[model samples]
Target: DAGITQSPRHKVTETGTPVTLRCHQTENHRYMYWYRQDPGHGLRLIHYSYGVKDTDKGEVSDGYSVSRSKTEDFLLTLESATSSQTSVYFCAIRSAGGESRNEQYFGPGTRLTVT
Candidate 1:
């Protein structure tokens, strides 16, 4: 499980509605990231955090927001979800230093649909 879990594993919502997805980790990783996977775009980064309350925008962050209040929890929010926002959301964690320093372990993923 990589000590990661995403809430609302499957969700269906209407357009213009606000949605929030949560990612929790038990591995005490120092870095957390949120990404979206689409048919043509593969996986695109939405946001990331290097430490608690320290976050930054990523490649596809226009319609999304993220917050990391604690080392074990990262949250991704869609202010107003659209059909274009429908995709599989993934949460990944990486250690700051170790043998697997560069490796990112991902969660099972959350499937979101905006209709």
Candidate 2:
């Protein structure tokens, strides 16, 4: 939790629908990331933003998209919800200035279930 916040702590939706999860931070970190965790897949980075409107796709970016409009907010959207995408999503932030510069702190997480 710390300074990061995630919206819709729990979500339930049907297949073929769209879903959007939000991440808000109060620490003003420069790096924000989105990750998904499943039973055996562990945690996979879906996308990340280094600055406002500057984002890059990660290894598991096929069905995910991310956007950052300000220093405090990051958004992750699923184009089409699917059973395979049903997992716990987490938002992480890496401080750019301090002793823990590269250390990433994660949010509580959002559990998404697709039926």
Candidate 3:
């Protein structure tokens, strides 16, 4: 919720193909993050952005990339699809200076399958 949305809620792609997922938030928070949820991995960070044009890679970022060009939009790209990358992807936005400051609120999620 919190005005957050992920595009192509579900997708199926072939291995080695490129894929890109979009995350949009109207909350205007200072931080946005991308994570993937898998049966064994639970949740692992893929990438995150603190502000427009500022981002950093996370633990499972070997084949992933991210970009944020504006406050409300962040993009996650899978340079090459892989079966191991098939999982539910989540987008989270940090609350801006509230009782929930630094607390992340997640979007519904995007499910990707690589064959």
Candidate 4:
């Protein structure tokens, strides 16, 4: 089975505020990424981490940030919530060992709404 997860299956917040979402993995993989899925466009990465405490921004990196302090956990934070940021977010991972690093697995998804 795929080894990835995300928190707050759903959330709603006001504009100009801050919000945080979480991702957790059971497998000890080395690559983790956070992406937002919106209508029309395909999944867009906001940030990713190659290892614990080593993170980098992704395609849609504005107004969002991420952190990974452990192999099993990653966090995404929005400095200020905006209507444009309202979308479903997904946490995904690329495994690092035992023939699990080539495929990409996604979390169920988190629906965030900024009003």
lDDT string for model 1 (31-102, tens) is 999999998899999999999999999999999999888889999999999999999999999866667658
**Model 4, CA-based lDDT:** 0.91
Q: Stretches of candidate 4 above 4 Å error?
A: 97-101
> What TM-score would every model get versus the actual structure?
0.94, 0.93, 0.94, 0.93
lDDT (Cα atoms) of all candidates against the true structure: 0.94, 0.92, 0.92, 0.91
On lDDT, the stronger of 1 and 2 is 1
Q: Which clashing pairs does model 1 show?
A: none
Candidate achieving the largest lDDT: 1
Per-residue lDDT of candidate 2, residues 1-115 (tens digit) = 4599999999999999999999999988889999999988999999999999999998899988888989899999998998999999999998766775568899999999999
Report the lDDT of model 1 for residue 45.
95
The runs of at least 3 residues in candidate 2 whose Cα sits more than 4 Å from the true structure, single-residue gaps closed, are 97-101
Error of 3 at 12 (Å): 0.3
TM-score of 2: 0.93
Model 3, C-alpha of 5: deviation from truth (Å): 0.5
lDDT (0-100) at residue 59 of candidate 3?
Answer: 92
Writing each residue's lDDT as its tens digit, candidate 4 over 1-115 gives 5767789999999999999999999988889999999989989999999999999989999999888888899999998999999999999999654675377889999999999
Q: Clash pairs of candidate 2?
A: none
17: Cα error in model 1, Å: 0.8
Q: For candidate 3, give the lDDT of residue 18.
A: 97
